[model samples]
Target: MGEERECCHHRTKERSEKEYKDMINRLSRIEGQVRGIKGMVEKNAYCPDILIQVAAVTAALNSFNRVLLANHIKTCVTEDIREGREETVDELLATLQKLMK
Candidate 1:
């Protein structure tokens, strides 16, 4: 999808086919990891084992975030700035603040 400005202030960013597929694949793996964690809980697996799995999932999510952030900076942020959309920078800063928190 191309950039969409919704009436309710929600925005959408279109991704290239490769980017979209990569994101979807990463999400599917994360979903599987979560389901595995739930299974571990149901099976009464060792606490340490569960914690390790959780950490793996957290790292995977962080990696995904890093990739997505890089893509956004390279594309959306760069394009917006080139087009004289100063507000995009402020929006990015606000997003970064929230991510950091």
Candidate 2:
């Protein structure tokens, strides 16, 4: 990521470490879920069960995206607004519109 796009919130060493750990933990869980799905496919699991697992992974990904987007808006976008960056607000809105679709 570009330096200019860095999150406005200043991260202490501890917070950085915690965030990294949390992300890694979440990713690992998602990885395990994906592996489970792969195994289910190989074993010819029931279609409904496979669909349920797929839905779960999609929900998990959407939840993760929501958290990241919330953080970005709270820190970066809010800072931009306070610093007289009206254009950034429009840019954010446009980006969100795309995401919603």
Candidate 3:
């Protein structure tokens, strides 16, 4: 009943400490990988080797996205839906579409 009311401001997520730490660790690793690639370039490493490192970074980012998406679906989306916010589902779909692209 009260769910039908309009929201004047955007919602925010409150992540658990574990989730936050996990994401931070993942990003730190990715950052390290990027720095390593830069070092390789500085030393004139083989193109193929540098490409492999870049691929590894890509995989790490994808893994991060998967974890984040799962958390979003479980927490934010679930709560929004329970509160009668069907629009959140559409927003989720759009975000997924962008991620896939």
TM-score of 2: 0.76
TM-score of each: 0.88, 0.76, 0.88
Clashing pairs in 3: none
Model 3 misplaced stretches (Cα beyond 4 Å): 1-11
Candidate 3's residue-wise lDDT over 1-26, tens digit each?
45442332176555667877999999
Q: Write down the RMSD of candidate 1 (Cα, Å).
A: 3.8
> Against the unseen true structure, what C-alpha lDDT does each candidate score?
0.85, 0.76, 0.85
Off-target runs (Cα >4 Å) in candidate 2 are 1-15
Candidate 2 lDDT over residue span 37-82, tens digit each = 9999999999999999999888888887787778677767787788
lDDT at 13 for candidate 3?
57
Candidate 1: clashing residue pairs, number:
0
lDDT sort, best first: 1, 3, 2
Q: How many clashing pairs per prediction, in order? A: 0, 0, 0
Which should have the higher TM-score, number 1 or number 2? 1
